[model samples]
Target: TLYAVGDWGQGKGKTWTRAGGVKLAKNGNAYTGTTTMTKGQAITARLIKVDANGKTTWDEIGDVKATADKTKTVDLKWTNAVEDTVDITINAAADLKTGETLYAVGDWGQGKGKTWTRAGGVKLARYGNAYTGTTKVGKGNAITFRLIKVDANGKTTWDSAKDRKSKADKTKALGVSWTSGKVNEDGTIPDDSAISISGKGVADGKLSIQKGNLAELYVIGTQDATPSDAVWWSDGAAVAVSGTGTVYGVQTGTAKVNVKVGNQTATITITITIK
Candidate 1:
């Protein structure tokens, strides 16, 4: 019998499994089995030989390395996995007022309890007008956080909204621009504004795309906004847009495309007509 082990296993103390055990081949020297794991993950397996009287012998230990097939969707197992420590760096906006202490609070240790009062806010250092800080969090898990400005009098004001990162890692860098704000009156953060889009190929607030064809449009934004701040989305099946404002007509139907940045949002309806 063969058993698989490592982070992919079921749970604590239940790490070993013979679920997909295989018998030795005709040569009586090799066996085969399969277990799915995420890309870049390393796993180990052991071959156990059980005799008639239940005596067990450990034969060989094999190391298995897994890689992802980008061409196909792979299921991920989240249980019994090790947590990686991720370092996060935050840069505050230029307009942050004086006497305000910048803080970082989220799902990690800085604010594990989810309450502002219990949140051990990590204070950022002031570098001229900008506040910066480096903090650690758990990788492969989201850290929902918001920039908070605490006045000398203990008054706390949150940024326009709470920003959440899906599966945070060491490579992520966050920027906080105090462009808009609403008091955390009820301890709830406001939603960030979306980007605005406009111009040619749009009619009556709707974009027209020929079925099985592609359409291009230029999105306009404020002088301070850059192309990197634009996020685009389509509400219908098969319709998609490139980061450079090029829309692909996948199927014949209507869809809504939304572009957002910070606290501004603009949406246009897409009408896909038969070619």
Candidate 2:
């Protein structure tokens, strides 16, 4: 639409006509002509209609009340001028279809197709067994772990899903895994690393007798210079040598060895007979 200064009383003719005047016609979606419109003037315009299939018609769609006189190109200078530019914004959850007229009026910058600046950042949270991170997530964002399932043994694997590679990026993440050897409920050596030794000469043997007896006490271990400590318990008392761990003495009957460290503990037994 276009407007002129002062009250262009001569409407619909010379003083006010379509885009190209009576001889020529406007082609675009919309066009208008206006005389100097004062603050109180009823600013109105006509809408060129179109059918569902794309048709134009000389029909009145909508209009807006112009702001005070001060809000204009030259203020009081040009009372009635066709406002050519107006700001506006169009938001659509889905794509825009046909025959959709998103319009605005009043002052400049009040038209469709205006862009807006969004504020704030995105958030993420866990939903059931899965997680959903929102777009625009912060760089150093973190979230707590919450488990909702327990194993058949009534034990929950909490803290097992902790992040391992501190330098890994979650955006382009490929995969994640963990490393933990399975252990028995009683904390015994897993069958995989268990040592099985049996023999009459080294196992079922006599250690002490009437001064003329010898016990073939079996000693099975690494010949490494650094010998692990040997821990042996007689009855209920704890006994040891240079170091109490997994070592044996010259003679021995049925003896129990208890080893403990950290959060793990193990015990072994050796048997012997008198000559």
Candidate 3:
């Protein structure tokens, strides 16, 4: 329900209330109105009483402007407007290139939440409901994502990722709000829910696979465990990856060994220190 009248110039206006205690104001070049009522009170404006069922509803009444004569009063009558909530969905894939915007939609009762997309993604959420945030991959050595939410007034907020148990745990926790796109208020990209590419490298700066001069691959993380059972590959003859982390190269030339982990791949160089 929208109305327009007069030559509503540009960028400069005042807001006020008028008629039937209908607080009105000129937002830039349009007339806006609001009411004061308890919950369950249907909003009545322009001969229409819109109900607020915990959802965002909106309808334009009409537009009015201040006459050049400086003698104009635009007043409207209706129900009050309260904050509502709605569900949103977002789906994004890894390896995303720039300029890819995430689509967001909500049931803004009336017709608000039209449609919006940000190339880098936007953060949104209800105060006590859920805190969520989103961002695109930026230029950084290691970048992490998290979801955050704020109140209707755009103040007071929370972050779901900050309270995550673990990277894997965050994945499961954030998958709930996962419609096709709307991720949970928590920032969690799981190996299964999301895509990932894991790569392996030998800091020794030598081709351990190519030379086949090595026995097998070991994952001596921060701990000094002889982690056996790791996959051992014969060679990259058929792009075969070591099931665990061990390999039996064919003592070949310089070859780069690699393994796949979900959406990521790991690679290692074998110099084949052939004696």
Q: Model 1 — TM-score against the truth?
A: 0.35
Residues 65-168 of candidate 2: C-alpha lDDT, one tens digit per residue: 34333222221112233333221111111111242221111112223344321121111222222122223222233321111222345442322333222111
Write model 1 residue lDDT over 237-261, tens digit each, in one string.
8576654455767788888887776
Clashes of each: 9, 24, 53
Kindly give the stretch of ten consecutive residues in candidate 3 with the minimal lDDT sum: 164-173
lDDT (Cα, tens digit) per residue for candidate 3, span 181-236: 22212223333333221112234323343332223333322111112222233344
* Candidate whose TM-score is highest: 1
lDDT of each structure? 0.51, 0.26, 0.30
> What is the TM-score of candidate 2?
0.17
Q: Model 2 clash tally?
A: 24
Ranking by lDDT: 1, 3, 2
TM-score, cand. 3:
0.21
